[model samples]
Target: MIEVRAPEPGDLETIGREAREEWVRDRFRTGVDFSPLMDKPNTHVALIDGQPVAAGGFIDRGNGNAIAWSVLGRVDERHFVGLVRAFRKYMKATPYRWIEAHCIATFHQSHRWVKCLGFVPVNGERCFTPDGREFRKYVFRNHNGS
Candidate 1:
């Protein structure tokens, strides 16, 4: 079964390794550390049979809202749905009134999934890689508790 839970200190090493591998495979720099970002109080991990498959967190913008980002590996739809449901429960119990995410336009599958999850595109911006390669950034927002 896939489960989502708050991240534990023991998971830091594993999460850091996974994030590093992902960055390398995705052609990013070696310094793309997620540790500082995931240090937030609400950071979470999606586990399948006790193996972490994904990580995400909510960063408060201090205006009754939070921005969230989830780095997921190739997983089944069941796990994806479970993660979303868990995130909803977590946010509903928090002080955040809004949630948003910035997704890469190249990730077509993620675009569709986010849309199905009720995240509409609110805006688009240009993002550049370390090498100055440009990419489209799609901002998606969800309100009304989802």
Candidate 2:
């Protein structure tokens, strides 16, 4: 069984390992540095059989908007999909004007995941991380904000 909950510090050990596995699978050009947002009010961990397999959260960007992000750990890919869906529903409940996610332009699965979470791509738009890694930005806004 999978559970989604606000994460505690102890969960980092497993979450970090899972993140390494994800980087290997995704082949991130600049590589990903896994950092759990446990100290943040809007973070969560996805666990299976009592072990964390993924973590994510949104950071308030102020003015009722936020930026979303997630890291999927090494686990049964079949189950991680459920984790993503659960996280999506949880984020939608937040009273934010809009929530956006940034994904590597080459990360096809991330593009798909955001789409499943109801995020539409900001077509023709692109951005770079502080490290200069390019990304595609996606935004999610319920009909109320749409």
Q: Against the hidden reference, what TM-scores do the models get?
A: 0.69, 0.80
Clashing pairs in 2: 18-74
lDDT per residue, candidate 1, 1-146, as tens digits?
87878776545445445552354245323455567767888788778778776677778888777877666555566676776776556655656667776566565665765564556676546666576655444333335432
Candidate 2 residue spans exceeding 4 A from truth: 20-36, 143-146
Best by lDDT: 2
- Tens digit per residue, CA lDDT, model 2, 29-113: 3445444356778788888988888777888888788898776667686785687678877787776778899988877877877
Error of 2 at 134 (Å): 1.2
The backbone clash count of each candidate, in order, is 0, 1
lDDT of 1: 0.62
How many Å off is the CA of 3 in candidate 1? Answer: 2.3
Superposed by TM-score, candidate 1 places the C-alpha of residue 38 at a distance from the truth, in angstroms, of 1.7
